[model samples]
Target: MIPSAMSATPQSRIEIDPAVVTAAGDFVVPEPLGFGRCLAPVVFLADYQDGQWGRGRLLPYGPLGLDPAAKVLHYAQVVFEGLKAYHVGGSRPMLFRPEMNWRRMNRSAARMMMPALPRDLFMDGLLAVTACSEPYIPRASGRSLYLRPALFATQPTLDPAPSTTFTFMVVASPSEALASGPLRVVVERTGARAVAGGTGDVKVSGNYGAALHATAVAAQSGFDQPLWLDAISHRYIEELSVMNFFAVVDGALHTPELNGTILPGVTRDSILALARLEGLRVHERLMDVDELLQMIRSGRCTEAFACGTAIIVGSIGLIGEHDGRLCPLPEPEGPHAGRLRERLLGIQEGREPDPFAWTHTVAPLDTSAPDRNG
Candidate 1:
């Protein structure tokens, strides 16, 4: 849902609604927490207009009141980022490489012709939400408080141009893995998810909207996600829905190189570094989908997996096609994906050493929640 901003609110001084504070106090963590199903009771918001950002606010989460003809509704002038706050093995919450997200979000905004948020503005929203929602953040293994910060055009107009006004929001969800088990992915040969020189590489809102149809088609084909190829030739692999693709080929890790059409996923970057650090060779090139499937069939490709902010790392049990054909990985449970996933999660959850200084600790504004271990 879109977030709304009130211009009349004070400037430079963040406003925390009394109701929001009380709501955060009374909010109860949901049972059987599904990813993004139940949102934290409060949301952090800020408005950008007249070449400046307004003071942020933390208010009760609810539906937005849009002008119905907003630019985001018609032209989709929006970008968003997905990251998590972890409260495991420590009372203070940790954010894994959030500066990367901040920078990537601004890149998407620039590509979308939107204004970039000031560093303080972006971090303030994130720190505010995480600090306020400390009591509700899930503390179990593989569970985290997923934070989503989004910016969308609020200026209502029919012209095909960037909106002068925008709304920025940060929302949180205490959640579990999006897909807990090994995934079944299908190759989408017919429909193209993104075109070269388009908004494919960025976190533009329209990129995901364009993938909805193929995702549904993949679901109907008995798969969890669609493996999209390059939009130009539809031969080379690109990425999966909101995730990056990886395969272990001939005792080495292989993934598609960034070609301006594939998303530079944070998890994918982490995996590459971790794999290299663990003495595994990694290759990023223009990998062909057909060749990958053939490698799987020939037992040369041992395993395949996808990584993203939500899934972390999900093994692909089998790769399928529109036709009734399947190419199962010889080692679907991974030998590589599993190890890489463990290492990545270890770094994320603070269970292992973070030599890279990727983990960022956010001091709680109020430690009303019980001990994280309890």
Candidate 2:
């Protein structure tokens, strides 16, 4: 049974969908699943209007109706978060550093002029849906129930004003580790993901959409991902399209400093913490592309990688352009990256101790009802 405490409190005025419980038992799990290959059967939803939030509900996954002129459609006022639930060491599903996502989501919402989902509601929405979908949580290490919580404008207007109404929803997917091998990244010089004093620091929808073109171009050119440079001068290395970039130089871990143009990824933060705990020298500072390329050429840069919720820790094998000018890291599978990935994944998968108290475990759903035939 879903835990009663997982439900929203009366003060929050949240409601539960009667159909969600029925749908949970009837939902089917597929075989041979991969990362984000399939979505869970249920979703948690809430709405905001007139300066107040309405009751929330857990509903079966489906499309949402929206006006074509909605601010989110017209002005691109939307933000989202990505986290995961682990089903390791036990049947229960556990979230890793979910509050960080909650806090980051609110920051994005604020940047987009959208009202932030209250912390209680945010946690409740996530826990409620995870509880409902507990049976579907993947049970293997390096596999998880990927949680995505997003908020968007709903008002139908073109006046460039903040939407009077907004919708927030949390959805889940059974996923495996995102990347399989060392990645090849191209140094992007033609496009920029975010500009200074812009929404680059936020997890807004526009940021990802803007990167798709460059990412597509890079992918077609035989590169796994694009290493974006600063939008102002295109000199300093910013990040990968979806993940933060890091390089191991002279045995020291160096990543781009948060310059208000990089998404402060949860996994990125966790890796930094774990690295420090493991006694590695970690530095966050401006990294110039030319200097890094030179270091790689001189064998001074031993390794490079990208980190995010999706691609936990992916080492970079090669870095350069499509014109045959490339520099490869001395050690594609560097000792530091391997150690960090193993340690972090170990904590996430329950194979090691979670000294940071990052995981929140949810009880399994009751399976007493007869399985429904679809």
- By lDDT, who's the top model here? 1
Candidate models: Cα lDDT each? 0.85, 0.82
Q: How far is candidate 2 from the true structure (C-alpha RMSD, Å)?
A: 4.3
Candidate 1 lDDT for residue 13: 50
List model 2 lDDT by residue over 37-128, tens digit each: 78888888889998998767777888888888888899888999999887776546677888899999999998888897898788877787
| Prediction RMSDs, each to the true structure | 6.2, 4.3
**Model 2, CA-based lDDT:** 0.82
Model 2 worst lDDT run, 10 consecutive residues: 1-10
* Per-candidate clashes, comma-separated: 0, 1
Per-model TM values vs. the true structure = 0.93, 0.92
For residues 1-374, write the lDDT of model 1, one tens digit per residue: 11112112122356666577688878888787889998998888899899989888877888888899899999889899999988886657788888899999999999999999987788878887888888878888789999999999999889998899999999999999788547899998888878888888899988898899999989987999999998778899999988999999989999999989888999999999988888999999999998888888888998999999899999989999888798878887877788888888877887878867788777555323232112
What local lDDT does model 2 show for residue 215? 88
Candidate 1's error at 325, in angstroms? 0.3
Stretches off by above 4 angstroms in model 2 are 1-13, 363-374
Which pairs of residues collide in model 2?
1-366
